[model samples]
Target: MPTDATPRPTIYDVAQRAGVSKSLVSLVLRDAPHVSEARRDAVLAAIDELGYRPSRAASALASQRTRTVGVLIDDFHNPWFVELLAGLRSVLDPAGYTASVADLALETASGRKPVDGFLAQHVDAIVIAADLAPGTLERVGVPIVVAGLRELGARDAGRAVDVVAGDDELGGRLATEHLLRLGHTRVAHLAGHSGPGDARRRGYESAMLAAGLEPITTGGGATTEAAGYSAACALLEAHPHVTGIVAANDVMAVGALAALRERGLSVPADVSVVGHDDSPLAAYRYLALTSVDGHSADVGAAAARALLRRLDSPDAPAHRELLALDLVVRGSTAPPPT
Candidate 1:
């Protein structure tokens, strides 16, 4: 057995063991096409036997590619991004790309630009999962894939960006329609100002209008749980007759729950509630929030694939993909109280 001090194996050793030229070993390392199958197999076998690991730094220097992707998220507190990151890794890992994660919350707290951090890492590409300041992405000079966001306005206008997102508007409509189907006549929306939040609000309004019911909406600031709670409180104060609430996301839905509890209201019994983003919190026995599943993981995977394609064909027309959404029924929604 080799001790900790044993020197790591190198490509030269691998080439010698396989009795192949170093250039041939390099081609095999890159999985390059047109290499003879027999030579490729020999190189791979020798690499396995000798435990030779390619130096990513050296490879990057030669190819001008770091094989790293910067993933920017809104907040770590939100569980929605957990599945999204898993999906991104699913495709990126197999493609030999590493995901470097950063959250806007922390970046702002530290008083640094999120894009600056990603650029400093020399990432080959960037996957945006959060909203940035206007023009924050200008002149990034890197391929960008907007993940899980239906709209993004901050980017280099001259460059084409790939977008892979869930149909948030449809998801919002589905959640509101679910509540409407559950016999809720007085439905209010806990709104947020973000792109997804705005889209969801529009969906709720559309459903209510279609049903010929007056729509009540409140909260147009943050999408945090605190924001949800505050908005719910304000909504209940102004429209206490509301029988249902459609929050922008699961965290906000939880906030609304707290607001309901304070007013001695029971979920689905007093007021049925539906939330968007079927995050892990929605599945908790205590919450059991009926929510819209935007398939964020699938969005992440699709975004990664788009990023790879962008890398391969930089001049191709920008890819825009909108994934479908579904709703997960839980304990939070039911027929309105009699």
Candidate 2:
């Protein structure tokens, strides 16, 4: 009684092909605990033979759950994001979920909006890897896991959200302490933008104060190389005795290197420098910049796991995960000039 014009293979077709009921096919697709291993294998084999693709939209309409997570990042140009994505994918892909990345190009300022497209797609949850704009969280209906920024409070919709962040303060302390240990008392910090920058700056100041050394800070907005170069110039002019610099991120540290070279200063000879976020570029033989590892990949995985836990129980209490930091000593740091 099958018509030639019948639509593409559905769960019913897969069930018939596998000699099982439609419910069994459904169970197999959902990876339900009740389904036997043999039955699941048979259903999968039948699906492969029939070229049946599960309709995501249809499944969502029936079960009111879309096994997808929305990820919004502040910027994509930074290599740190690539590592973060690797971590996120490792956790989500094995769990039968997909992450839709939405990059808000902060450079243009116009493209700096949250994942409105993903929200329109009705993803099951959202992970924000950057600092969101004011009032953006108010509109989000699904469970949210915020990484990178830690200040997002409960939403107006009464939906609790989880936050994941690196120990940036500790990272800053480590970087400054490294320079201090190398006998550089006149150290300066190239701080990032508002959120993470403030914490790092605080750490730098705390460390400097503990050493009885005056703390100097220059703005390295958004952790960019250009900003680092400009900030380094200002810091050098103001504090000529500064023999050490702690940059908020690797990009800034690289910029500081260029600035120092342009001024006829040799790295680790005239000055020692340290950067945060031990990005891949920092390890290059030419750069060999010492940096603090923010463990961005671990943070991403933690964020995904937290979101999954929330998806399992929407009423679960809010959680906060802070990844540990590590200091990577490299060629960029050395004892101050005697």
Number of the predicted model whose lDDT against the real structure is largest: 1
Model 2 alpha-carbon drift over 4 Å, by segment: 1-63, 106-112, 155-158
- Which of the numbered candidates is closest to the native, going by highest TM-score? 1
Per-residue CA lDDT of model 1 for 1-338, tens digit only, reads: 11234687888999999999999999998889999999999999999998777888445554587799999999999989988998899999999999999999999899877877887677899999998777778777788888866347524445788889898989989999998888889999999888788888998999999999998999989999999999999999999889999999999999999999999999989999998889999999999999999898899899999999999998898888999999999999989989
- Pick out the ten consecutive residues of candidate 1 with the lowest summed lDDT: 149-158
Clashes of each: 0, 0
Q: Give the CA lDDT, 0 to 100, for residue 172 in model 1.
A: 86
* lDDT on C-alpha atoms for all candidate structures: 0.89, 0.82
What are the RMSDs of all candidates, in order?
10.1, 9.9
lDDT of 1: 0.89
TM-score of each: 0.81, 0.79
